[model samples]
Target: MLSRGGAVENDRGSFREFVEKQKQKGTLVLLKKPCSLSLELAGVMKALDGKPVYCDKIKEVPGARVAGNVFCTRELICEYFGIRNEELMPKLVHAINNPSKPELVEGKNAPVLEVTEQEVDLSKFPIPFHAPKDGGPYFASAVGIANDKEYGRNCSFHRMMVIGKDRVAVRILPRHLEEFIKRAEGELEVAFVVGAPINVLLAAAISVEIGKDELQIANSLAPLRTVRLESGIEVPADAEYVFEGRITSEMVDEGPFVDLTETYDIVRKQRVMKITKVHHRKNPIFHVLLPGALEHKLLMGMPREPTIFNEVGKVAECKGVNITPGGCSWLHAVVAVRKKKDDDGKNAIEAAFRGHKSLKHVVVVDEDIDIYDPESVEWAIATRVQADKRLVIKHNEKGSSLDPSADPNTYATTKMGVDATKPLVAHGKNFEKAEWKAIKKEEYV
Candidate 1:
């Protein structure tokens, strides 16, 4: 996390004060007075156990409210991108629509003072243990940078789990970075980061189309942010925690705990890494992610939003999606769409499956319905849908790895979809859209 900032009169970048200063305006919910993250970490443990309370000292840092709950809500995500939550999609579509080249700055030193190429230590910093069953402390969240084998461009956000003080497991999908790692002869360059421009982490989460470098989409999200290759690592000038390492073919047991899907997964062999260098600002904040939390769902599933929106748009006036927590945030998705035809709901079901190949089940609702409201969606299915007509595919489709009922080794299971939308042309022919009686203004008052 060697951040390099330039002064008005100098081409040489100056090392910024600390991680708290690099944050957007005021996101540092820090207690200037000394308090151990160890104490706060214990509090987080209890909070997840249904008892949450933060140190009263933290209440002093301007907008420094409690940071225990999800630090990655939709509102928080939008604020990070400098956009309204409602504008997230169009902004995403816009960025994907108009990609730009990232500005690169090269210098010996940056706000990221020294690289710390040698004499690296994992201790001496604040790293939280987000979950009880985690292998060990996780240093960074929402980041892991790897250069592509097809092209030397960097692809980031493949999570890294701490195995020990000097080791980590680089989690990668078989066909993904695994392919890149293989192409590179099983020797891969990796950098674990705590924070970046925020936009870069979003794009790198899911590189939907090939060759559309996330760095390109990142530059489109915020101004004054530049992308550069430094000391063989791709990074933002103000990144919080950065560690340089190498992912090798050496395998180790990766997990036996809950995932973003919020369900426990069987431990399996995953690639291991040896840390070579550790870089960060003074008194750096080490972020930890709970196995299954709001932040986890957003990081693991939200990136799939644009793909779903794009696919569903072809079939219906699709608005957005919310992966219900009850369904482990991965097995099921509730899509919101405006029915253009009688079968528009069914069309949306097909699109959702295409967007996320692992989706086990999908429920499509009308625009007037609230997808986030369980009762609202149930009402639509109960009143507008006929089980026989609305229910779409129910056959052997790919099953989610998170579904405990499904055999992860074989991935054998069925996928189901329900089309819950009001019939456009019912017993009446050429009917106009339904309208309700207008209510008196301020009637409740």
Candidate 2:
């Protein structure tokens, strides 16, 4: 959904191109389902299905496509941002801290009101049943365009549940739309736009402490982006659909299903709103995100990575960071650094915790080791890490409420960090890689 100059791709590719690329890569699997909505189908799909395969077109949302595994893998995320996997974090951080504000353009065909549906019905949209315990159909792909309290314009992503024909339960967080909601004191005006551009969706999904109005960040990410809309709702003009709505104080049961971290979460008693209207194009295409899939983690985790990088940069030459898979996209953090001082690791540890607040385990390693490599990081810790000198463990630290293990509604649990960089020593066998030879790909492949 390009909003300004031309039809710039929201991501590296278009919705059609995405399918083509997946086809070329021989990655996407085709399946035939009759708009399956059974609770068991969703569970089976998650438990048994492979990576980002297309569900083809569902009967309910005709001409619409649903793809999962969007961010479950690094290659997919790299594809989305048009960068190498190694460059994903830095690119995201750069884009987040220095986002370009959206430019308004005159357009009567603005998606928010274009073919606006007056007789709204949530059931008409292909809302998926992610889990058996899930309360209702969820629009996992929708982008919640939140109105900033201080600035009156900002947008973020929060899971919304279709509680009614004209309403949904919005899940906004402190660093995201929830912050704006509080600024408006319980009742916040918002625009819930679904069937989004992939890049715009990603920009909203993988963002950090960025100011209100991330459409600009998304636009800058896709330099050729052309956004044009005059209805006060700042969004890509080419996006398939955009609906203006509000988050109300009305509360309802939210969830008791599995989350992105691959954990069964019990999100009970949440605020739900009544949907007033919906807008979409004729035979508009609908998109759904795989709840708790790679794309979900990437979109959710990558943005937070920048937050950690910014905070840790103050203390060390933090090069890059990644939230490991074992951490379920929220629990663990792996930070790559060019350690300048002996205490750089500790500073990074504190900065990481401070940056994310919910991080439990942090590992700081030299740039030589791949933070994404479990074995490599383990080797660094085994050889260079010293518990007495490098390990920093603090009790009763803040943690994630999404973490069922953590004591919720209270203080954070114990968190720890290991400086996996080799100790700077002259001759004490302090830190050195054991003898190993690099092998050529031809020898193995």
Candidate 3:
């Protein structure tokens, strides 16, 4: 286990503190060259997809800084939470199960409210034009927080495209935010927070009940403080930037942006948001999440791991779950379980699908197999799996929108589950791998 002591322990829920820790550890890359918001900054971000990057010289926005790939990998996320890889699922599950309210601070003491501009101009910030096919400069890292009369409050990620000085076309899915908008009669007040802490970011991406507040889950993960905006929308007090906005009845075409699968999403008429105010801390750092990149995939997929683990646990003694990045971290997953019966693997497969509706493929392995290692999982599949008996397939199933091969209109695809667990009783062939005792190489040499 990694050490849980030091600066990280002291500043567990502070985004700036985490960045500074990464800098001290030499894991964060600093870009001294001036970069442009139009493709160049995103290009650099993509080029270094799995490493934390910071750039202070923005050609478009003077005195502004941008950071990317901060939590791009599972290891980085674990480091942020001061946990090991094996502990992630339990931590997430605990947070989801036991959510606690965050402390509310006044606007006067909130760091985010240090600078507030009533006359909003989004173009003045360092929003990125990620790819050539993108509709416009996007705030891909923004987590929108909105409240409803019935649902109370909802926090979720909404990709927004800058359309004017104070307006943005936001892609609103038929989820909690949409429900909140409808409840508010097609106009809902929202606060889009950028450069939030890892706990808040992970909690926002989680799919919970509509009325359940994600900020509470974030607080459970780590102590969180929030400040209520003038619009009555509460946001993280330590966030880099907060855009006080309203999702209006007006709509505009908003897409051609890269999705989780690195494919261009089709244009659709989306809701328009009018930013009434903008607030940021001194020397604010913008979070630049390049569309369809590792950071994007992890944020979208990691939260689903706990759900899959929970469902699989109902059927079998679940050991671990890995949403592989090779599957775009959305469509494919590997589950490890302590197989008690011959049918436990199959039962786990069914439960895993029930856990995450968007999962297209899953492989069930014995507890001995390391689900995190692709080679180990492949070895298990090759050795233990007999396609004729262990393969389970479902045709024309509802799948993820990120998968390009799925039906464009319906998003339906074929799903497969492989029971790769070894039989309890080996009849003719040995299923276990032969291992030698541990040896000291240095002594032998």
The CA lDDT of each predicted structure is 0.62, 0.68, 0.90
Candidate 1, 350: how far from true, in Å? Answer: 0.9
Worst 10 residues of 3 by lDDT: 1-10
Summed over model 1, clashes come to 7
Name the candidate, 2 or 3, with the larger lDDT value. Answer: 3
The true-versus-predicted C-alpha distance at residue 292 of model 1, in Å, is: 1.1
Candidate 1, residue 326: the lDDT equals 63
Give the Cα error of residue 89 in candidate 3, in Å.
Answer: 1.3
lDDT-best of 1 and 3: 3
Highest lDDT against the true fold, candidate? 3
**Candidates' RMSD to native:** 5.9, 3.7, 2.1
Comparing candidate 1 with candidate 3, which one achieves the higher TM-score?
3
Q: Per-residue lDDT for 65 in model 3?
A: 87
- Residue-level lDDT of model 3, residues 276-377, one tens digit each, is 999999989998888888999999889999999999999999998999998888999999999888899999999999999999999999988988899999
**lDDT, residue 139, candidate 1:** 43
Please report the candidate that would top TM-score against the real structure: 3
Better of 1 and 2 by TM-score: 2
Winner on TM-score between 2 and 3 is 3
What TM-score would each prediction reach against the true structure? 0.81, 0.86, 0.97
Model 1 lDDT per residue over 1-445, tens place? 2222221222122112222232333443433443344335534533453211222233223222222322356665554444576787677777776777765655343343334546665554445544566665554364766777466555556556677777877667764566678888998887776655446666676546554567677666553233344446566555556777888889988765557655556778889988877776443434445556665566666666677778888878988786676675667888998777777888899999898777788889877788778898888777777677778766666676677777678777788898877677667542234689988879767
